[model samples]
Target chain A: MKTLLDLLMLSCKKASELIDKQLLLNLSLKERLMLKIHTRLCEACFEYEKQSKLLDKLLLKHISTSEESQIPIQINIELKQKIIHNINPKK
Target chain B: MLNEMDTNNPATTITSWVKLYSDNLFSWALHKTSDREIAEDLVQDTFLVAVNSFDKFEGKSNPKSWLFAILNNKINDHYRSNFRHQTTNNTISLDEYFDANEHWRPEETPQPWLVESSHILDNPEFTKQFEECMQRLPQHWFSAIHLKYIEERKGVAICQEIGITPTNFWQILHRAKLQLRKCLETHWFKI
Candidate 1:
C-alpha cells in the first residue's frame, strides 16, 4: 500500500545526490524534506552523510598542508642545467 | 642566440631566471604531478614557452604568477590528454550501490567510523593513503575537488576552470566524495 512516507521517500541514489548538492547549493523544501525522511529510514544514507562530512574536513586539512604548503623538494641540478641550455643555446 | 645578459635585462635573462626560479617551479611541479621525470619535463616546457613569449610579459604581472599560469596550463593539457586515453571502467554507477526500489544494498551500507578518526587527518600515514586515493580518482574528478576544496576556490571559479556547468560540478563532487569515502574507509578507518 502507498503511504505518505513511501511517497516522500527518495532512493539512495537520489538521496546521495541531494547530499552532495547540499554541500554546494541549497535544497528546496521538498528536496530537504524528502532527503531528511530518506536518511531517517535509511541507515546507509545516514552513515554516508557522516562520512562525507568527515572526508571534507580531513581532505581540506590534508590537501592544504600537503599539496599547498609542501616541504620543498630538492631540484635536480642536472635538469636545471639542461633547461637553461635548451632555452638559450648560445649561453 | 645573442647575449642578453646585460645589467639592463637582468630579470629577463635565461641564466638569471633559471638560477632564481627553477628550484621553486621544479618543486611545485614535482609535488603536484608526483613524477620526477614528468615534473622535469614540465619545468623545461614552461621555460621554453616563457622564453618564446618573453616579449609579451610586459613586466605587469609578477614573474612567479605568470610562470605558474603557464605551468597550470601545462598540467591541464597533460590531464586532458591522459583522460581521453584512459579506460572508461573507472566510472561509478549509482545502480551499483542501490536496489531498484532506491534503497541501499546491505553490502553498500556504510559502517560507523570511529568518532575520533577525524584526528587521523594529521597523521602522515593517513595523509599518504588519502593522497593515493585521490590520485586513483579520474583526473577530472580530482581536479574539480582539488580546485574546490583544496584550493578553496568558489563554485563558479571551479566550474569555469574545469569547463563544467554548475550542475555538473555538483554531480562530480558528489560522485568523487562517494569514491573518496569508500577508499578512505578501506585504507584509513577500516571500521
Candidate 2:
C-alpha cells in the first residue's frame, strides 16, 4: 500500500516523461494504469503532465520550422581565397 | 557529417572543413552561452584549436562530432576562466531542495496556467518575465535548466558533457526546477 506521497512522486516522474512523446506512447499497461490512478487523485501531477506535453509540442514545432540559410557566395569565395593564400603565400 | 573531400590537398581540405563546420560550431556555442558574439569567438577559437591538432583527429568519429568535442572543451574552458570572477548567491542551499528524501512536494497540485501557443509567442511581457526569472537563477542551475529544457539534451548526455555523475545531474536538475517553480510562482504568476 503506497502512501499518497509515494504515489505523488511516481506521478511526478511520469509527468516528466510526457516531454518525450515516444516514451509516453510506449508506457506499459501497468504504468498507464498508475498514471490514470495518479492523475485522478493528483491535480498537480495532472497539470504538470499536460503542460509538459504542450511544451514538447511547442519546442518540436519551433525546431522543425527553423530554416538555415546557406553561406553567401562572396563570403565563401573570400574564405576559399584566404585559405589558398595561407597555404601558398607566394600566390 | 564530415566534408572530407580530397585531404591530399591540405589547404582545400581545411577550408572545406571550416566552411562546413562553422555554422554547426557557432550554433553549438550559441546554445551553450546564449550569446552570438561570444559564440562566434568560440567557433573561431575552435577552428584554430582543430587546425593545430589536425594530426590527432585520426578519423575515429564523424568530423562534426569531432568538431563538437573540441567546441565543448572550449566552452568548458570559458566557463572555468570566468567562474572565478562571477558572483553566486549563497543564501540558499540548492542541494537541500534536491535531496531524494525531501523530493519536490508542491503545496497544492498546481493548476496549469492555461495559455494558448499563439498567446505565449505574442506576449512579450510573458517572455520578459520568464527571462527575468531565469536570470535570477544560479549559474549552474541556469545551465542545467537550459540544457535540459531548452536544448532538450538527455540526462546521460548532459552528465557526459558536463562531466558529472548521473546522480549529480538529477540533483542539479531538481534544484533548477524547484528554483524556477518558486520564482515563477512568486514573481510571474499574477493569479
Candidate 3:
C-alpha cells in the first residue's frame, strides 16, 4: 500500500527538476497530474512553481537585453587587418 | 552590398567579412566565453577557418548561422579541453533536499517567492547577482543553460551543439537550475 506521503508529497528536488525539464520538453500526463496534485497539497512546491516560471520569464528578458546594457567591445581596424592577415598569410 | 553572387567570391568578400561580421561575432563570443581575449581569438579563428575552407563554400544557410556554427565548434572544443583541468561540482546530492523517505527537509524547504519576480529583471543589482551566479556554474552547464534560456535555442539543437546526449543535457540543466535558484534566493530574493 502506498503511504500518505507517497501519494501527497512531491519532493522539492523532484519538483524543481520537473520544472526545469518542462522548459526543454513536455512532461507526460502522469507527471503533469502528479505535479498538479503535489502543488495543491504542498505550499513549497507551489511557491517553487511560481518562482521558476518567473525565473524563465526574467531570464529570457535579461538575456535579450543584456547586450544593450553595456558598451559593446569594438573590433578596431587594426584587429580586422590582423584577423585578415591570420586567415590569409599570403595576402 | 552583399549580393548572392558577391558572397561566393572569396577574394572580394571574405576579407571584408571582418568588417561585416566581426563585431556581432565578437559580442556573441564574449557572451558565451566571458573572457575578452578568448572571445577575440575565437572570432579570429572562425574567420580563419572560413577563409581556409572558402573552396567548400556552400551558402545554403545564412552567413550568420554558418559563422556561429564555426564559433560553436571553437567554444565546444574549448570547454571540453578545460573540462579536464577544472573540478566541476555537479554532484548535488538529493539527500540534502529530502529526508531518507524523500520528504523535504525542514530547513531546506522551499518557501513562496515573490509573485512579481519577473520585475526583478528591472533591478540592476539583481541582474548583477544573477550574472555572478551564472559565472559560478560549471562551464559546460553554464554554456548549456545560456544557450537554452538566453540564446533561446531548442533542446535538441543545444544538445547537438554542446555534444551531449539529451538525457545528459536535462541532468545538467536540472543541476544548474537548482544551483541558480539557490543563488538567487540568497542574493536577490532573500526568502
lDDT of 2 by residue, A1-91 (tens): 9886565445354443332323213556666666667667667667656654554444333322222232111233443344435544466
Off by over 4 Å in 1: A62-69, A72-74, B1-13, B35-38, B52-92, B115-119, B160-162
Q: List pairs with backbone clashes in candidate 3.
A: none
Q: Is candidate 2 or candidate 3 better by DockQ?
A: 3
lDDT of 1 by residue, B46-132 (tens): 998888777777666777778878987886666544533442444556776678877777766777887666677666667678778
lDDT of 1 by residue, A1-91 (tens): 9998879988888988898887667899999999899889888889998888787787677554455346465768998789878866676
DockQ per model, Cα: 0.57, 0.14, 0.44
lDDT of 3 by residue, B146-171 (tens): 56665566787766765566666677
Best-to-worst order by lDDT is 1, 3, 2
Write down the worst ten-residue block by lDDT for model 1 chain B.
B1-10
Off by over 4 Å in 3: A1-8, A61-71, A74-85, A88-91, B1-24, B53-92, B99-108, B115-119, B122-124, B150-165
- Between candidates 2 and 3, the one scoring higher on TM-score is 3
10 residues in a row with least lDDT, candidate 3 chain B = B83-92
Model 2, B8-71: lDDT tens digits are: 5554566667767666666556645655666767777776676667777766677777887788
Answer with 1 or 2, whichever has the higher TM-score.
1
Q: How many angstroms is the interface RMSD of candidate 3?
A: 3.7
lDDT of each: 0.74, 0.54, 0.70
TM-score of 1: 0.76
